[model samples]
Target chain A: MNLEGLRVMGIDPGLTRCGLSVVQAGRGRAVLPVAVGVVRTPSGDDLALRLLRLSRAVGEWMDEYRPDVVAVERVFERGNVSTVMHTAHAVGVLILAAAERGVPVHMYTPSEVKKAVSGNGRADKKQMTAMITRILGLSEPPKPADAADALALAVCHCWRAPMLFRQRAGLIDGRVSAAKRRTPSPDNHDRSFPS
Target chain B: MNLEGLRVMGIDPGLTRCGLSVVQAGRGRAVLPVAVGVVRTPSGDDLALRLLRLSRAVGEWMDEYRPDVVAVERVFERGNVSTVMHTAHAVGVLILAAAERGVPVHMYTPSEVKKAVSGNGRADKKQMTAMITRILGLSEPPKPADAADALALAVCHCWRAPMLFRQRAGLIDGRVSAAKRRTPSPDNHDRSFPS
Candidate 1:
């Protein structure tokens, strides 16, 4: 699969502050940053109104950037239940927006994202920000952890898209081997990319 | 505030099966059933597609019924984590759809709905179905537990609307008394209405 010039949008979903970024895959092991920012909703606002605001912001980004694929961080049930619920809400809206626009959506777990970007599944926030800055050749680390995280997600998707495409192709062709048939399990560390 | 003729839509949000119902408030405790059904999405579909399908179904209902308010069953953290996450995602879409069309949305807990309908906060499903059928004057109990739950939610909101209105009024007027200011607590059973 040719990933060159493939545009990807990544979203770090949250009610209070959602990170948004667009990145394009370059020749090889190179990613070009297109856009990066955050969308925020006031905590005091009604949940419906907040969701509406976030939806509109994301819709506008989709319209403007028009990425080929959207990658979002999958919500996990490990944190505070209320916080997880809110994040899941944002994720739902994001996915709906992408699907409405007829764009394919992909979700990557946090560890998967960190492994793809920083070569360490347990990379800390500072490490992720540093790696993202280096990968995107940005002058400074993206402001707020959310913004950096979004960029990392996009980069991760860009790197993994080819492999994902191959995996899907194998499944569609009914040629999945024994190794591929096994549900992929997470490892303590991933070295697919150099740190 | 007069609630006569006020139409309310209740939603029991879930990914696989979402129950939807609309009811109109008549004079006093009289309630008229306007519409009732369930929207279903295949479990095998992708999460994005499932959410999109549910959102469109709910949007059509909102557009066709044009209810004055939407009452949704609030998502809690007590259930299976995965189920709760899926339910919350559906809830987010429902709330967004209502907000998009400028319809006000209110959420009630399962216990609150049970209490409002059966006068018992701990009423079982059979009791709730029986009470809902009696309250709505339906010849037969609504089929599918989800459908019955939806009707119960709408009826609960109808009965509690006046009190919620007064509570909001007190808050806006900044004259809430100590009793009014305290967060309302739920008791084991309520006998506001004869069962």
Candidate 2:
């Protein structure tokens, strides 16, 4: 069995609304919402401090759960430039938290995750929440959109990318190697010149 | 032999100075300084376009290098409030580009790179350049402050975290078993949680 007992830390990283969900992978995986909330940097509040708080929260999750895999939603299609930029900074802090631990990080596109959660690739957020609740057998909706997105990433990894079942879950290339193979290829992980 | 002569793309991500470096990781491990330049947003230029340009340039690098790993410099300390916030956004864009292609990203802190390159935990720029030049066996100093930082990260990984080198580097949480324990612990990726 590839995933005998794998716990996945799924993150919907956002500047204002960041949702963190932890799920245990078994024959049938169940997403237990370990932590979920927002980091609202009100006017005059320091953005850097907000980011610092987010990173630390994620790190704490790392220490507590000791997850085998971390699935973060790729920030690809945000329309606003500065907001997109802020989202990017949040991601930097998030990725930094993961990378510092020497843990490999994998990013899933919004569409890919939506498809995993909703069956239809273009399903709306309403559908996503409905599907997520059904798949995980949840009592209520995952709450905010980011929370749904967080669960989507976990479900995506559980259903779409199963090898995350492995302990390391070394990055799926995050580009060509990951895109091309869509599964593990021979050259999936080349650590010759690491970061 | 596992590396398959992969090319590693090194990026020193910044708001004013984002430097891109390409190093081919093969049997001989050739570290070639292909391109080094900065994208100045020109004070009032469209931040989006500037980012789009940065995105395009990064895309071009991805096309040119076809890097197996996108090594990024993890943000360590940002003294300026607004400056640090903007820098975070800039890095967010960079991660998006790599994430789009599924480009595996790795990050190292300023201190980690400094210690790796110069044998001193608190080495400054001049000391860093001297060590970087020596390690890459370069005759001339790499231009632009951030470019040197970028190249240094790539070389830092090459010299310090060699793939075949079987030695744990950092000194924390070694108790977890890699044999059955997968610890996705990151360094300098400090953040505070609700705990």
Candidate 3:
């Protein structure tokens, strides 16, 4: 797989509803969505059963998609404690699935996901939906908010992959020059929804 | 493997410190301690890396011990949300490992463990330790509290397994006659430590 043209699977992890999306990204070109879906486990089920359901779903996706990289939303302590705990469990299962399959995994903070997709770190849900729909050339934002978040993460990972790849390869010197310090790139320009 | 003589692996799950104990129990005899240890992962490591460390450790135990059944303490809500989250993640990895290996898995609540080990459902740590040491014919209780909890769980499962097996096999009469209900067997009168 060319580092420039990578297949990425992004996950918005949760126990009740886990969002998963796969995208093919190429240099200087729009991304192509390969698949977008959510895995649902009933809330009343045992936690162990719920995790097992997620593990199987994730394992199946990995085997079928053969993604070069898998990205998951980092679990933060913003929501209800129970919700955060469940999300952490889901993320753990996803990470284990990817790790066992030998697929590289990355975690994107929620703010970073928003910034990558909408060009604003604090982009609201409406702005995020609009930008992702336009970016993916979808008729509308992906069904359900979680799917949109997952697609946004995939797009974000693709956009940032080169910098990450460079850093990982110990080639960051060429990418980070003295002049680029403390200056925001023009590529980060945010556009308003055409209202 | 004889059904009457079963080996069990009990886990007290935690991300940083997972306690493991193996015990063998046979009909009308004292439960024997097979092994006891803890899997430690550094808190400074990435969550995924920590989980991977646990997964490998659990896999190693499962292979080396080959217990007839693997039991894990059910994750319960308590002190800190973060602590519960980490424990849930640890338990999920363990359950997945056992499920993948075709090993039977059981979950015992903390109260049930204490009740089975000691007569009281809410036995304190000191009481539980004394009971387990006496029950297992050990000179002293297992160290580090976590190991004791694990051994308690394993012994509890063994003590309860016969009743569970009978219930599952439809051995007991449908009515559970008065003659079968009230008499405590002579073998169960282990009063060395007192009730």
DockQ of each: 0.74, 0.10, 0.31
Off by over 4 Å in 2: A28-39, A163-195, B1-195
Residue-by-residue lDDT tens digits, candidate 1, B31-61: 8999999999998899899999999999999
- Listed for every candidate in order, the interface RMSD values in angstroms are 1.0, 12.4, 2.9
- State each candidate's clash count: 0, 15, 0
Candidate 3 lDDT by residue in tens digits, A84-157: 76777677788889878878888889898887777788999998988889888898779898899889889888
Query: Which consecutive 10 residues in model 2 chain B have the weakest lDDT in total?
Result: B186-195
lDDT of candidate model 3 versus the reference: 0.80
Instruction: Output per-candidate TM-scores for chain A, rounded to 2 decimals.
Output: 0.90, 0.76, 0.87
Which window of ten consecutive residues has the lowest lDDT sum in model 1 chain B?
B186-195
What lDDT does each candidate get?
0.89, 0.65, 0.80
Candidate 2's TM-score: 0.47
Q: What is the CAPRI rating of model 3's predicted complex?
A: acceptable
State chain A's TM-score for model 1: 0.90
lDDT of 2 at A143: 78
- Sorting all predicted structures by DockQ, with the top scorer first, yields 1, 3, 2
What are the TM-scores, per candidate, against the unseen true structure? 0.92, 0.47, 0.76
Residues B1-195, model 2: lDDT tens digits: 244356677788876778777765434333555555555555465344455556667878788777777777775333665456556656766766676576777777888777766667698999888766765667898888888888877765554445323334322345533532354533221111111
- Per-model TM-score of chain B: 0.90, 0.76, 0.85
